[model samples]
Target: MRIDLTNIPSEGKSLHFTLTPDWWKSDLDEDRLMGLEAPLSASIKLYPAGKKIAVEGSLSTRLVMRCDRCLEPYGWDLSTDFRIYLSIAPFKGELDVELSEDDLSLDFIDGEFLDPAQIIREQIILSVPMKTLCRKDCKGLCPVCGCNLNMTRCSCSSTYETSLYQNS
Candidate 1:
């Protein structure tokens, strides 16, 4: 939803919004989030300051991820919280400098309607974790016997969970 800052308060205005999962386009990362089969849900607050908008909120969703050690699909929960500022000032020849959000600085965009879908895409991408695990001591599938060691036993001298990291 677009927040027209034409006549907002100087001290900023408090606004709350909830966005559903259907608002986003599917951006599946085959490598991450397992098979990339889930969408993010958003709850946010906006504080408008002149032509600047400060956003803070959280998005939660369920992810199907591959077990880092076993290569099996597992259910993983993911959530992303964001606190960022965006400037919606009109472009004038008076200033031609690049904008940034470093160290809680500033980011500039066209002084037009803001697309909520774009905001969601950015938030979701930034929230993904670099690494994920099924469990701290997950006994993954057996390599030799092709059995899920966590659920079944293997007779062959197949690799075990504890042995996988013995060298490390």
Candidate 2:
């Protein structure tokens, strides 16, 4: 999904589209997003601002992910509304110039085209949680017998459990 910013009007153009599971290939190394449980719907409005462009939109989708603890599959719902300002002109300042606070979120356009796929991929990556668990109270697996604690209780003495977390 590329948007040509060369002829964008001052009032901007509003566009709406859907991203299906077949549209994108996962590039994550580990704990990757398996697929989309529902279609991803996006609505964006691009407008010209000076030598830059402003992008504002919202995207929502339900993703299938693998649990880090039990390695089981699960569904996670994600939705985000983003506002970004892009600059098409190159910065001619010195190489050693220090960045201001506003430079943190500023984006640069490439050849008068705005690649929405890159933006969507970045947003999805940022939205991923550091830790993925099926549930907060997940008992996990038994260290001795490798039994799922959530399913069945192991006969390994309770002392083993007490000693495991004592040092931590």
Candidate 3:
């Protein structure tokens, strides 16, 4: 999970990692991510940028998620690619100093190591869909009976049917 900065050569390095659900359980739960299905895998490339280290990588995994509409569990495939710049130099002077756009992409390394697992965990959480649905045409659940509209017709449908026939 942690890589030694001293090992990174000026010519750059390529690294791959595999992780399990246990490694991300804490962060996933904090983000309310439910039902992880398989192992997480990633491939990363590190480049030396003067005093800064540049990291670029991609992560992929399968997850079991609940449908927001039907309340049913379903499987989803997730993949994401990201790039970040890391520096060992701490910003000096005032703690409340203002930062420019260039500072936004810069991440300060606390020591001489980088935690790739932590970065992958954050990226996974950010990739989660805002609105999760099992399908595009999901009818959702019946409000009164709490029945799945996609599975069976609820008693409420009969009431509407009777009213329509009575008016004829």
The top-ranked prediction according to TM-score is 2
Residue-by-residue lDDT tens digits, candidate 3, 64-150: 777887788777899889887665556541112123233232232335666777667666766778878788866677766878877
Taken over the whole model, the C-alpha lDDT of each candidate is 0.56, 0.68, 0.68
Q: In candidate 2, how many Å is residue 20 off?
A: 0.9
Ranking by TM-score: 2, 3, 1
| Candidate with the larger TM-score of 1 and 2 | 2
Model 3, global lDDT: 0.68
| Residue-by-residue lDDT tens digits, candidate 2, 1-168 | 667776788889898888887765675554456767888888888887666677788889988877765566788999998776666545541112112233332232345666775666556756778878778766666678877777888899877656544532
Q: Which stretch of 10 consecutive residues in model 2 shows the poorest summed lDDT?
A: 93-102
Query: Model 1 TM-score?
Result: 0.60
Kindly report which residue pairs in candidate 1 clash with one another: none
Candidate 3 — which residues are off by over 4 angstroms? 26-32, 90-110, 157-168
What lDDT tens digits, residue by residue, belong to model 1 across residues 1-168? 565534445665554455554554444653654433456566656666445666666777766667766667787776777776655447541212222433221122224444444555566555556656678776766767768777788786744545766732
